[model samples]
Target: MKHIIPYIAIILLATVIIYSNAEKERTRITERCQDTFSDAIRTEKKLLIKQFCMQYRQENSPNSLSVEDKKDWYDQNYLIATSPSRHQLDSLFRDGAHKINRNISTAIGYTFNGKNYFSGDESCRKSVIPVQECVYRKDTISTTDIALQAYIHIPFYVPLQNTYTYAVVLMASVALAVCFLYTRRRKKNMTGIPLQELPETGNVTPVIPRKVQTEKWMKLTDGYQWNPQNHMIEHAGKTVILRGEALRFFQKFIVDKHFFLSYSEICRLYHLKEETNGAKDRAYHSIKQLKDNVAELGIEIKSIRGKGYKLLFSHRNRQII
Candidate 1:
């Protein structure tokens, strides 16, 4: 029984050793595959590597390879060869003979049989010769070896399948469409002038030097306006008339005083200062007109609730001519 036990132990040990050796050989083959084609894969032709693995394995290890060995041989080579490197192929090859550690790689051209080796080749001799010298020199040959040609073509098809450029074009087209719609609305509004008849300037009385000073004061006021050029007290436009009598009165007050006044203060001077509409319907219409005119230029009139309406100019607006 004891003798049988020892034999069994020996059998297990042999099995372990055989497993380890097989694993090492598989790893070595994978590394050799990568070193032979790393430059080709990185140059964006990875299909060549897959083809090389498939053809090389079928020819060299047909019946011997287990499922795991077959998968590892191809997958490992694909990963290592396709990885991005700090330097490009032209630069790495130009450096002339770089050594990758055996822990990370297998010796180049160490396959079961060298791809270019012929059975009767004198240089190889088949018996005592090292495999390295007998293998075809990659530096001298620009063409891919027969085994790798198909695998290296995979990257070429990747860019054609990409959809990002189309998405960018779609977004740009949508933005252009929005701008076109807004411009059409504004042009329509501009052609039609509201309240074109001149109101009586009579009994409105001339406030001379002060009126001239008010014109200058309007220019220095801290506010943005849709038509700053036409905001002078003397200037008249359709926008001002549609605002009812309050805007005209507000203009009269500023001209009479020779300076700018806040909206609420202007409302008070015109006796339409209350938020209620009863005595102040003119003031409400005036404020609405100002907001609408600025809106045409892509600007907004934002009311500060307790304060007053402020003309907010958008940076995107084209400066009014």
Candidate 2:
């Protein structure tokens, strides 16, 4: 659980960054939709106004123009601009939004005199449209008495190569690479030098090895050394750490051994009740573990039937022999 902290932190940080960027992008798209709608409407209005103006001028001469006539003309043009049907509104919005951003999708909504006159998308009829990424806008226009509103919205997206997505992916890749290298290096260190690659050991050099020992490190025989602090044995450039019960057994052995430990003595050391199979099993398992860890040193824990255990060396590893 402790080791998982850094990755968890990275994930949370990535989430925040991505969310922040998405919100910023949504806001940007909303504003862009507003701008695009205004521009398209403004441009379209200019053309419509020019076309109607020409028709009005042709129908009624400037000299004969009356207040009613001008008002009537304004009313007709306003209806044409604001009161287009659902199909027309959708086409206008879609085309207008796409002109600005080719990938964008748009829906039309309109209300006249406070009643929903036209709504394009079904979800737009309710709240947000069918799509999650969308923005809405509605504006009121007074033709004469009734209030007319033209509603439109555009929805854009964050591009694939946007800042937040790229940043998170890059960070994840780097983190994985670092973890892999760290594990590989640790594994290599623990494995040490392989025996097949080792140089052959010469005959025993008693003087040189004896000089290297301190009170805490015992040079057992010749090539094998017992490092008490580390609970390890080193022989012929190979090292092994004694683990758990094995370590405890070795510690007791170093302090109390006179070459052997009776089964009762082992039981006392481990606080196991005497005259029980548990004590014998505990002693047996621990010594077995100790024996395995020091196998490279050719040290063995020999069980004495109906008695206890003693450490022994095969003739090949006993320098004097």
Candidate 3:
């Protein structure tokens, strides 16, 4: 689990960066499509208004039957744009966009007087370009008195934009990050305690096991201390090393009340079978080794019949803890 942490972090970082860049690219495509749609709609609307006004001017030409009809035609056509003919405008309106926008379904529509008209998908609805007034952070799109608005949505669009510059940069950055993490971890392992500042005879020195540096030492008596890192007890310039089951039982005895150890407790510490023949003898032998080692420091172990063993300290070698 510990070794898998760096790989997990790399995956998450790549995913987030790729997702953010894809969203930015999608936004750019949507804006370009909106501009294209707006230009087509505006140009068509201008042409329709020009045709509507042309009828009025035609009445004053030589083709007109009389001057009285020309005056009446001008009056009737003055407010033609205010109450524009939907059927006439619809004739000019066309779905100017490609059927597929980069392989994603697209539709173009116009809404006027609460009625929608389009030659594409029926699901397309009117929308503001960029969606918000302050789109980037706090801006909005332009608004107009004209009721005509275009539909601009790419339904179920995939994030496979044609441009790859941003994606390339994102991949390169993630690769660098992953490489840096691996390199740093390798450097830490390479840097350990220098066995010696310099080797003799230009030879590499073999690594000797070094005691772990720690501040905690179990104080037994005023002059007796237990160096657990080395499993050695020291007293009066003498050191006694305890190992194996003896060392474990010694450590447990320090924590037990009255410095006591029962036969069953000793068997459990050494993982020996309990309540079996020779169980007491096995427990006694393990405890005897620990007792004999500490006896040099004036500590004695006394046995209680049918019970357990206890460590007894003399007045001169009273326990400090």
* TM-score of candidate 3 on Cα atoms, chains taken together: 0.33
Query: What order do candidates take by TM-score, descending?
Result: 2, 3, 1
Model 2 C-alpha lDDT per residue in residues 171-234, reported as the tens digit of each score = 8778867866876687688686654555788888667554565547687656667887777777
lDDT of each: 0.37, 0.56, 0.53
Candidate 3, 139-219: lDDT as tens digits = 111121123333445543345454564665577677768777887897798787564454458667899998877656787
lDDT of 3 at 287: 67
lDDT of predicted model 2: 0.56
Q: Write the per-residue lDDT of candidate 1 for residues 275-303, one digit (tens) a residue.
A: 43222333333554554444543445444
The residue ranges of model 1 lying beyond 4 angstroms of the native Cα positions read 1-266, 272-281, 316-321
* True-structure RMSD, every candidate: 40.3, 38.9, 39.4
Model 2 is weakest, by summed lDDT over 10 consecutive residues, at: 131-140
Give me the runs in candidate 3 sitting further than 4 Å from their true place.
Answer: 46-100, 114-146, 155-158, 163-321
Error of 3 at 299 (Å): 96
- Candidate with more favorable, higher lDDT: 1 or 3: 3
Candidate that scores best on lDDT: 2
lDDT score for residue 310 of model 2: 68
User: What's the TM-score of every candidate structure?
Assistant: 0.20, 0.40, 0.33
